[model samples]
Target: ITLPLSAPGIAFSLVLVFLLAIGELSVPSFLRYPVLPVLSFTQFAASYNFGAATAAAVPLAALALLGVLIESALLQNRVFTFRSIGRGLLISLGRWNPIAAAIFGLLTVALVIFPLSALFADAFSLTTLHDAMQRAGASIVRSVIYSAIAATILMALGFLLAQLTRDRGQRLVNFLTLALFAIPGTVLSIGLVRLWNSPMTWFIYTTPALLILGYTAQYCAVTTRLSLAGFFLIPKTFDEAARLSGASWTQRLFRIFVPLSNRTLVCAWLAAYILCLRDVPIALMTASPGGDPLPARILTLMANGAPPMIASLCLIMAIASLIPLVILARVIPSRGITG
Candidate 1:
């Protein structure tokens, strides 16, 4: 019975995972998986064949657009009753519980625990972590700064977009974000390069602004969606009462809507920041020649880097991602998790 209502969430999740898989760069490149993103990057960066790169990305571009359209359709002019999840009765697992637990435990060990253990052992050796810090300190700091700026911009825009589309989804904004996100990062970087490469726009192209723009364009979809969920939780009556008393839209937004949705706002910012921090192709393509972010630095070191050194670099990346993720976990209410 719950499955019927779950269909929308399940479909969105499937599309989300599909887009992530298609946009992924590191694992596919490292494992030599011949994925679309890798092929597109190679065509654009290595071969200098823009036409071929664009052609290779057509399928994923369509796929990302389809996901956005489906998302809009799911949300279009509808009041989401996510709380209705409680209406269904739980099915008892009986004897299958222990078997299910064992399967999950083994999978967790194999997929998560074992790999992390290996990475920890290799990364924490004498001088490895220190060396990684020394080598990538500037890059890590730069990543954080860039991620911060981009996240702030994204958060503001996401809130505004969420407000604009409170009743209906914003088609153009959604489409633009999907284009930047679904299309090859390399292709987007190249487009940015061409757009702002000239002396007139040197300030943007030569600085971290270019990287921030790429991050904003790609992740706007994500932050907006997250923000919209928070927006939905707000009572329209609150806004109405404030307006009747002559509270400006800005005042109500900052004083009422914002505080009520503070948790989700933070979640949106954190999500955008992490996405920006971990991105590879865009940073690699747009970063200053000597000032690559940690992810970009890892790729650079991968060719001739020692095992310990690479592991340490990767460990630093993991830690950077983990701190925010931990906070995200905490900020989420237990009821939210159960729901």
Candidate 2:
């Protein structure tokens, strides 16, 4: 009973991780693993074969769609409610508590602590970071601006779509975003190039707007999935009561739902922002020449830059992303998001 009840969360994790992995560029590139994303990226960026890139990405997107369909059927989402009246039994980790703690600590050290320790050690001092700022300041500024705008757009889209729960619109949206995410950024960039590179659309393709579009396509799933979980936690009775009291949809959504799930919305936006800010593949493929974002700039610098200078840029990127997220998490009222 408990396992069945946890299906949505489990499925959410699997789907998200699968999509992110499919589109990821760095790990596979570093390991020289000829993954589909990397293959598609090579075709577009290296060979300049937009057709071949599209062909590669389209099949992956299609496979992902099939998986989404399968998930939809197996989950029987139409019958699943976030506000279910029946609760699952809680299983306590009585004897396994120590073992679980050990595993958790090990993962934290390997994934987070060690990597950060190395970056900090290499960066050396304030002077190096200051020099990094001078060199890549414009790229950093563009990254922040571009990511913030994309995040805001996602937050709005997520909230509106989550309100359409159990509807065809929600299902269609889930399918589209998942499919878009599964397609590698380079392939999506190739599509954008073909669609907007002509004389009529040169203004959009030539400017930063194209990068924003690419970010939107790749990261829409982050906020939408988060919003669905967040809004679903709001008891339907709250919305029903508001409706019966003659409150408009907008009024109820803002006055009641928004206030209740404010933190989740903030978190959704933050997640999207971080993904956009640290983005490499999408920016690499779509950014105009000389206007590379921080991540792309870092990739370029790796060719010839000093190790300490590279470390400084990496540290700056971490600080730029971490500080805003930390501030928002602490400052925002966590009244509604219990978990």
Candidate 3:
């Protein structure tokens, strides 16, 4: 009846409100109805129950406290002095310690090369490799497209936002951008789910669009930071020079600012793409039940007791993700690209 009586906006808002209410109500229902009964049953089984769980927790807490105290004592005794530790690490890795240096060099090579090699091997394995490839074939292509679209949207938004704000307001914008860095991916996922879990937002929740949205919200700040840095690097003089040359604002940006910041823009795009590729927590949480990105699929495989397959899948993804990073590293010069 309410659905029929309402307009689109009202109906959508009502549906969201209903879901929020359901989520809110489920908490107390779980605690009072289920949790209390379970607690009572456990208490009866223990027989001497003076809240045995709570009592057991106390000893564990004391042991944790003792460990912390010992750590503090060792730290206070200069066992972890910053300068001394730094000097020791430097000496250990330096040529003065040839064996240590050799060990360190081998470790570094293993760290860098082993993962890629393992992934390459796994990607070619007879049984699992074929299955993972088939599973991820179209989805990998779609994820790349989705990532590119999201990065473009983010770059555009960041540029517009930077252009609209004054120097003083930019500080405030920067603070807000930095603030997002503190929000964990899971928290952002919950917020996205809550915001879009409505009949009207069914498309977002059901499609890969929600994954894109989650990635955008989490990494908008990174895009803003990269673009803003690029923006600053393009001198105010360039804008003035363009204006005096009879170029409009759009022309000035297209011909001057953007051309000058091409490297930064590419770097930003690379950062966004790499982040989107590796983003496991948010992707896992937001992915549609039917379709998931490579990272999420790897995680799902792991959870379903397929370690060898997961390892193989992970190796393939690591290689795939590395291709962009390697390209970006090669393309971006140490010196800035100026118009």
Candidate 4:
């Protein structure tokens, strides 16, 4: 019973870490490691062998698909059933309150405060920040614009997929999204290149549009899950009432569903934006010669740049990632919402 109840949360955590890890390029590339994604990149970039690259990616793609199947099997019996918040019993940590508080304080200081302190210390100078910005300003803007576009696209796609899966038993869409999420960025990039690096699709293949598609493909599963969870909170009666009142599908969707799903949409958009913003592998592989995103630019510069400048660039990226959280903090309180 407990396992079934906790399955979704566990699955979400596992998928999150797995996706992040599998798509990563810098650490493995820098360490000269033979991780799947890095190996694929090497085959393509170092040897310029598209066929070899595709062949190298086959096993990685198969493993990712296998993982997705395992995830589905584990959660097959875990239905989406939410209970009223008021139904749960609350335990007051009266005796352990101080101890719990102390533990949290220590963790916050160690995990959050300490790392941020070092970043600030290394990247504190205004001159360095300005220089960093001046040097990679275009890439910075590209990262933001591309990520925002990708996030918007993901939210739209997520809502449609979530609605389909929820009301029509089209669970295959959900499974496909999960499978796509499991694909490493390098493997996906190879497929994207093969599909588009031709005369027929030349108009799009060499453009930033390719990176946008990669972002959408890589992160749409997150938004889909978020949207599905949001759909669960909305009672079926609302839709039924709207239909009875002669609301068309479009009317019911915009008039009822969209209004109720604002928070979920916001959360999904933010999550997707952050994922795209921090991504490097997808951009590295898909971005045109001069269209590299900020993270990719940083990785490239790290090879020859000064330590302080690199640190500054990294700090800027960290701050950029926090912008969504800061927006949520301000907007949620202003709207009288609580966590």
Residues forming the 10-long window of minimal summed lDDT in candidate 2? 77-86
Candidates sorted by TM-score, best first: 1, 4, 2, 3
TM-score of every prediction relative to native: 0.89, 0.82, 0.66, 0.86
Better of 1 and 4 by lDDT: 4
Query: Which pairs clash inside model 2?
Result: none
Candidate 3: clashing pairs of residues: none
Query: Model 1 off-target regions past 4 Å?
Result: 73-90, 168-172, 335-339
Candidate 2 lDDT, 79-122, residue by residue in tens: 22233234545678999989999999999999999988999998
How does candidate 3 score on lDDT?
Answer: 0.60
Instruction: Quickly count the clashes in candidate 1.
Output: 0
How far off is residue 306 in model 2, in Å?
1.8
Task: State in Å the error of residue 210, model 3.
Answer: 1.8
lDDT of 2: 0.78
- lDDT of the candidates, in the order given: 0.79, 0.78, 0.60, 0.82
Q: Which portions of model 4 miss their true places by more than 4 Å? A: 1-12, 15-19, 77-112, 328-339
Q: Could you tell me which 10 consecutive residues in candidate 4 have the lowest summed lDDT?
A: 330-339
Ranking by lDDT: 4, 1, 2, 3
lDDT of 4 at 99: 99
Provide the RMSD of all predictions against the true structure, rounded to 1 decimal.
2.9, 3.8, 16.7, 3.5
lDDT of 4: 0.82
Report the error of model 3 at residue 196, Å.
1.2
Report the lDDT tens digits of candidate 3 across residue range 36-78: 3223223423353635534433433343334334333333311
328 Cα displacement, candidate 3 (Å): 1.4
